[model samples]
Target: MEQGLALGMGLDVGRREEEEAASADEEDGEVRRSVEPAVPLKLLPLLPVPRQPSPPLLRFPSSTATRNLDASTRGIDTNRAPSTEEAEEASSSSPNRAVSSFRTGFSAQRGSAERGGVAERASSILSDEEENGLAKKKLRLSKEQSAFLEESFKEHKTLNPRQKLALAKQLNLRPRQVEVWFQNRRARTKLKQTEVDCEYLKRCCRTLTEENRCLQKEVAELRALKSTHPFYMHLPATTLSMCPSCERVASTPATAAADHRPSSFAALFSKPTPAAPRQPPDNFRPQPPAATGHSCT
Candidate 1:
């Protein structure tokens, strides 16, 4: 009987443990259901996740890669001999290559021609510049040079070859330039002298004209005086007398000297004559005239 009671108690304890395990399972299912999302997880759309940046890589060229790069660069040498395969390829395309080479040579020739033309133009421009420089040098002289030349000209109007050479050296000028300056200076001096002489001749002509006009007027006055005074023109010849002191001929008016001349003549006639001899002469007289022998008796 004790054995039966123990089995019944063991069966009741196993039942209680089974019920507690089932209740715990039901509470866990309820908690899981409440924590779940409203929408099903399988029905939601997915998004891509952002990845983190990776570290930079530092890669170096291997020896074989560097050799390949060098070979590729050196394969383009223009003077290098072609390989057998390349020669064959070039032969196959020889006509095209020939056309391209001809075009290149023609373009090179055209470029050279253009360069030659440019050089020629540059040479012409340089020549023009040189000509302009020479012209400027010839045309323009400084004040000091001009003054020196002027002083030399004052000292000598004309220059011999030796003198011109000396002056050119002293003034730092060419002999031709000095000679030309002297020639122009002499021309100017001669022209100035000619002008002065012309002015003097004009003054002399004016003075002579005035003198001639005055002489003509005096001659006209003398002619009029002679024509108006007929008595002065026709004075008697006897009225002319000579002065003993001055020995010059003088003339008196005939009417005024006539009465004086007759008075002087009468005074000359009235002058006394000498008286006759007296009785002394009768006493002194001796005899009558003596007769000749042949007188008639």
Candidate 2:
């Protein structure tokens, strides 16, 4: 009986513990339900559904529409209006006709543009030639005009604008023409002066060259004489003298007398013979001798 009582107490304790755990779990669930928000089913937005792709619709033209399209295409492809038979043929060979027609059209357009450019260029060139021909026309001056211009140029090499205008009026020529004539005259004068100066310089150069050549030849001849006759170069130079009273010819340093001197030492003491007197010319007459203080015996 005591054992049964103990087992019944233990069972009651276990049941009370289980009851406490269940109460705690219920409180937690209540707190959770109070904290969370509640939404109505009708207030929520619905998700969109993805659409599927549909196949494309194709509509083929009728036979009449096809014929009409071919006829229009052929008309555009050809330059002239196409007949019914040609249109049919073009339609039969549509691809080739289209290619050939495109090439021909492009070439024709290019040719036309090129021709227009060439024509424009030719016209411009012709206009330019006409303008240049008018601008560059040559005028001939009469003898009076030339003579007057020459006289004016002789007075003054250059002309003032007023002078140029006056000259042009007097000569019945344009001022530009007058100015050109003066310019040409000055150029011709300068050219002629330059030619004269050039000729003078050439003559001077030739003269100097000839002089130099002659001097060189003289130097060469002198050098040859020295080389050939070295003794003549070494010989002492001698000059001739005349005594006024006796009119005798005397050689200064006497080259011939020295040559005739003896080689022996004894000849140094020999008395030298005097040279003969020079003869007077046949046309000359001797004057009488002047008297001296002492008379000759």
**Which candidate has the top score in TM-score?**
2
Compared with the true structure, what per-residue lDDT tens digits does model 2 show for residues 205-253?
A: 6645554464465456546755876664455765655443334343433
Global local distance difference test of model 2: 0.40
Model 2's C-alpha root-mean-square deviation from the true structure amounts to 50.2
Which pairs of residues collide in model 2?
Answer: none
Model 2 spans > 4 angstroms off: 1-136, 234-297
Where's the lowest-lDDT run of ten residues in candidate 2?
43-52
Stretches > 4 Å off in candidate 1: 1-140, 231-297
For all predicted structures, in order, the TM-scores are 0.33, 0.35
Worst 10 residues of 1 by lDDT: 288-297
